[model samples]
Target: MKRIFVLLAGLCCISCLYPQAPATEAILEAFENRSRQHLLHENEAYALTSFSPAYLFDTLLPAAEARYKKHPDTWLQVHLLRLRANAASNHRNLNNNIGIRPESVTLTEEAIRLCHLEGNDLLLAETYFDMAELFNLYARHEEYITMLTKAFEIADREGHDYFPGILLYHKLAGMCKAAFHINSYRESIHYGNRALAMLGALKRPPDLHTEIFVYDLVGFSYKMLHQADSSIFYYRRINELLKGRDTSTVFYKLWSAIANGNIGENLSAQGNAIAADPLLEQWERAGIGFGDSANISLARKAQAANYFRKGEYDKALQCWLFVFEWSKKEKHFTNAAAAAEGIASVYRRKGHVDDAFFYFRQSQVYNDSLTAFNNRSGLQAVQAKVKLENLQQSLANSKALLKVEKRSKQFLLAGIVLLAVIATLLYNRQRLKAQNRLQRLAQQKREAELDARKTKEEIENFVRHIKEKNDLIDSLRDKLSSDTALKARQDILEGLSEYTLITDHEWEQFKTGFAKTYPSFFPAMAARLNQVTPAEERLATLIFLGFNNLQIANTLGIGRESVTRARYRLKQRLSLSKTEELEELIAKW
Candidate 1:
């Protein structure tokens, strides 16, 4: 009877707390109805590439901020608001530059900080999903995958809900795409299938757009893995989905062209260029009509690949040259490099040794430029991490100082109270003591600065050691390649490949050393070049260590022209004047 009464009391308390469940449900339903109205008109309200959509953020952000201030502890509410702000900012910025935007990163970091305070795992998972998007914008594939894994784990633990599942599906699909870009075929396929599984697990079927992207990612991943039949199956599935859809819509035509082009590319890859011709032509026509020069160029490249596969060297050479020129003209270094490489390979096949060497050197220059660009991006991430750490440390110091100050004030107040109750003689003595304490604190700060410089020097030495190890590995590789009689040449080559690429362990060590030595450098550099890459950062590191162009070129195993070109490209990315030296900037950093 006591247990029953206890249960009854608990139920009564719950009933008292939530007495208006029915009314609450009605209000929620009304809000959801209004939200659906907005979702339905998203194209008009939130365009993919338009500043006009920014008004939505301008209108919604103030309201969201106002509400967030009222319920500061509700992380989910604030995160959703932040997501809207980020999306709106991205929509506006992507119209001008498709690379990472400053505002998006700022908003994502804010959301991440809020996620820590959320306490609820599910809400925190959503914030992770938002962070993955920001990482994706910066082309940080590994971090993107890591954040996605966190979100997936929490969502799985919490038991899948429809809303979170929607995000998971999209994120899974995006991870597949990113993995493909980074050339991790197995991981791409894994995430692609995960997305497909997510679609199956959804209570409501995915909409056409989601289905299209999922199919495309899966199909592309399969194509890369050389699973022709499996790839063809998914591409055909996309065709089935697009069946009877309005062909007039830009998205519809775009996907249609992509799907058909992919099918042709698959056929061509299988040594049937003749069979691929019709589809390739169709895609090219559609791309040209749509004013998508990039896609048109891609179609041409595929056609060139088809010709090369068929041993039509002249035709292949013509197409490759056209692609190289087009890509170079557009400053698409990656595409240009690919084309130049292709041209060089064709020249070698035709026994034009000099031409082959020239184009090969040109390809190297472009490749090195791309490498430097990627390195710069890594430097920026390192900088951001260091900056965040410094900010946290500063915050900790401020809190500590505030606590001390508060305690001192409290003691002063207490002393005043006691003085009023007893005597006034001690008040002047307390004021003098506080002034003396302030002077000591100032001296301590100065000592701390000197200690920090010492630590910085130690970290610089460690980073220098890391660089020496890298240089040694490069020298070893060159020696091995030169020594044709080396018995374990292939084994050594495989081992070198494994070790030379930056593993997570090595990256963590580098980050730690960088953070210690260049605590303020990365943030300043990142602010100047938001889209910097890892290769550029590596170059900058060497530059900072007093390596000149020739030395950097030798260290990186690229030609001096490549080094010079990389510097030029870095200058452009940094928006520096021609007179402003990159080395000078690195020195400042």
Candidate 2:
């Protein structure tokens, strides 16, 4: 009896060491319950503060992994992998790491694979959304959009009412707004509206903050598109929603001020100065109270516009001068350009040609600086895009090779089973074909990369040449001023300006070269061409080509001040925002 008790005790120890894995349903239910709890409180603050990385890593992840190891089920493993990735991502984000962790991406990809294998559309959609978030964290915007689009398509196909569809729409709208391009604003509005529609369709009380966010996005997009009436309508809708809310809260006050400010600006743009003034004043006061420089400047700009429209030139001049100095001090080149232009306009209307000319030149200088900055940013974006595309191509090639190897193995097995004598021959032929295909793919990738590199180098060289030519012209101007006979100096200077003037034939040649370098430039400008004069178009092209204000003046054979005036006029014709970089818009187009 004692010997039997000893054996039972030993058996009990063994059972303790190898406990049974929880059922798959129980594991899933636990995950779902925790996820729901986290997501429910997620919007209380940004940065996923509701979800604890420590808890996920220390408790949930171990539990999930243990179950996954024991069961080895596709769904179980997918959930386990997803949980691991989420934990890693959360940890990185909490640490303020701007980049994504490679492990997180790998784990997410594995989860995606398992989801596909299990034929689980909802799981696949969720995995795609997580991948999109990962790409977003890495600032791989194109990849982020691609992933989001795939998830959205999957959600639509599966007819998932809320889990991902609404979230997808909301995210896409925000992404479009962040793109900072005019066309993207239209897309933002489109997605934002759809999100609102979906929210309305829900049976339960919708998320108020989400509704407000979508409304604000839609309003801001319309404002960027210069649809002032529509923008005002949406802003008013926001105000209507905020009417009964607690005005003492920061959130309510902020949104209320934003809506009022936007409405005022739109009204002013529509030439309703009387109606805009009170709102502008209110916005200005709110800006001052909040100490928000951007809002303050915007309000002041709108006020200046109203003053100018009301024939209050002195008041307009005062406001513009203040904004100009402040913007210059703050190094806000776009605002500086707008304020300088405003000052120039006020001076011109006051019959102060010299003052107007001086301010116009100032505006032009600021504009040139803005253009240079935008060009640099655009070049960086292009380089990044090329790198991303190459990476994507490489990944595609790797996937293809994997698929080929998988198929080859399957074929080889079939051959061995059906005809053992021919198995070796089939394997040799398949191996040779795979090798040939790999070589062809490698060659294509190399050629494509070479072409991209050559194109980029050529564009850079073209820009460098333009800069060198401008430098030469500047040197000539200085030499002529210093060495010319005093009596003939004025004549020489005038003659030089005339000599530098590009003739029609020269312009045609220049345009041809430009088209070769940037084939889409003219086509992108086609819609706006009718809005500007031929001279304005030429100035814009030179600016887009990276010409400084002095270079543009020399090329056009005009006074430097005249070039500045022309730029100011061009900006007005474009109807761009006070802070919108002209070159940035052209580059995006």
Pick the lDDT winner: 2
Residue-pair clashes per candidate: 19, 0
Tell me which residue pairs clash in candidate 2.
none
Q: Which consecutive 10 residues in model 2 have the weakest lDDT in total?
A: 1-10
Per-residue accuracy of model 1 over 452-499 as CA lDDT, tens digit each: 787677657755665676678678878888985666877886675454
Please give the lDDT score at residue 338 for candidate 1.
78
Could you tell me the lDDT of residue 332 within candidate 2? 85
lDDT of all the models against the reference? 0.66, 0.67
Cα lDDT tens digits for candidate 2, 346-427: 9999999999999999999999998886676566556655754664566566667778998999998888777866666688
